[model samples]
Target chain A: DARVTQTPRHKVTEMGQEVTMRCQPILGHNTVFWYRQTMMQGLELLAYFRNRAPLDDSGMPKDRFSAEMPDATLATLKIQPSEPRDSAVYFCASDDEGTYEQYFGPGTRLTVT
Target chain B: AQSVTQPDIHITVSEGASLELRCNYSYGATPYLFWYVQSPGQGLQLLLKYFSGDTLVQGIKGFEAEFKRSQSSFNLRKPSVHWSDAAEYFCAVGEWAAGNKLTFGGGTRVLVKP
Candidate 1:
């Protein structure tokens, strides 16, 4: 079955370190979304892209977090100078064009010490 | 702006019992609605979605939801609960005019009892 895949399923980093998470969307899907999930906040959308072009990144920390779609298959979210508050499970979901449904990857669980 | 509200933070039901999870939303126009389930350490799975057409939509895992425009509610329900159904459920909204930006609710955790 077609599925979105994320790398580094679990990451533990010291405070002030940089962490990068990668996602490979299902082939031919044009829209991709990045979300962070936590006990207090639940699920928050950090960024999204359509056809490899970013549509929004407003929820992301503009100074330290960045999301980019280098190609149709690859989408990346990076955090510089990570903090303990940044520790959460980050998920990547891709939407099949012309539909309202989205398929999500298993997600990357990050722990910042 | 669009928003979703899942009032129940946690729900407990016995196996084989009926289940209903409430979800409400606020948007200026008709919005796309969805229900998703997440297991521990797993990504969110789309259980169902309602964009248009019939207000009652059937989903996988024997889940269904009814969209009520007057009340701005999309409640998910199941005829009989299973132990495997114990998971976190989330309600989300998407606006077609907004590039399909999704807004998710706080989520409701279902605990199935034997």
Candidate 2:
């Protein structure tokens, strides 16, 4: 049973703080995706990477949000000077290239005050 | 761009009753469809997916979805509902042109009564 793993299952931070969420994709998976879930927005794709190279991050706020796959195993999403509106559950998912299936992580619940 | 729509925001059903959740999609070409279920405080789990060939696809936990290309809909159905089946269901369309990135629906919350 391979699964995507995310760190800091829950995070609480004040406005203007920096928050970092980490994900470990399944060992053999090559594509990684970051998504944010909110009551208003449902699920929004923030960014995705293929072979440790970013494919798109258009949905993400470039001014404050950054997504990176430092290596094959680790993918990270960071928000600098996070705002109250950034409070949402951030999910990390991974899949093998050419496979339409995406395995999701447990998600990190972020609460910005 | 591909988009998905789950019309029902919430549905309540009695245990042992049949269940159906509607999903409609918008895309110019043949699209990859998927259904995922999310339990409270948990990640989304794949229920089923339809790429091609079969219009009706069987999924985990006794769930199935039928794809109707003419209507642009992929509706999920379960023969009988159980109390444990209560969860939020999401419909998604995969955009192959964009590295198969998924566009998810607003989701429908199912509440099963005993």
**Model 1 ranges with Cα > 4 A deviation:** none
Interface DockQ of candidate 2: 0.86
TM-score (C-alpha, index-matched) for candidate 2:
0.99
DockQ metric for all predictions: 0.88, 0.86
lDDT of 1 by residue, A1-113 (tens): 99999999999999999999999999988999999998888899999999998898999999999999988999999999899999999999998778867899999999999
How well does each candidate superpose onto the true structure, as a TM-score? 0.98, 0.99
Q: Extract clashing residue pairs from model 2.
A: none
Give me the overall lDDT of model 1: 0.94
Clashes of 2: 0
Off by over 4 Å in 2: none
Native-referenced Cα lDDT, model 2:
0.96
Worst 10 residues of 1 chain A by lDDT: A94-103
Docking class of 2: high
Docking class of 1: high
Model 2 agreement with the true structure over B33-54: per-residue lDDT tens digits: 9999999999999999999998
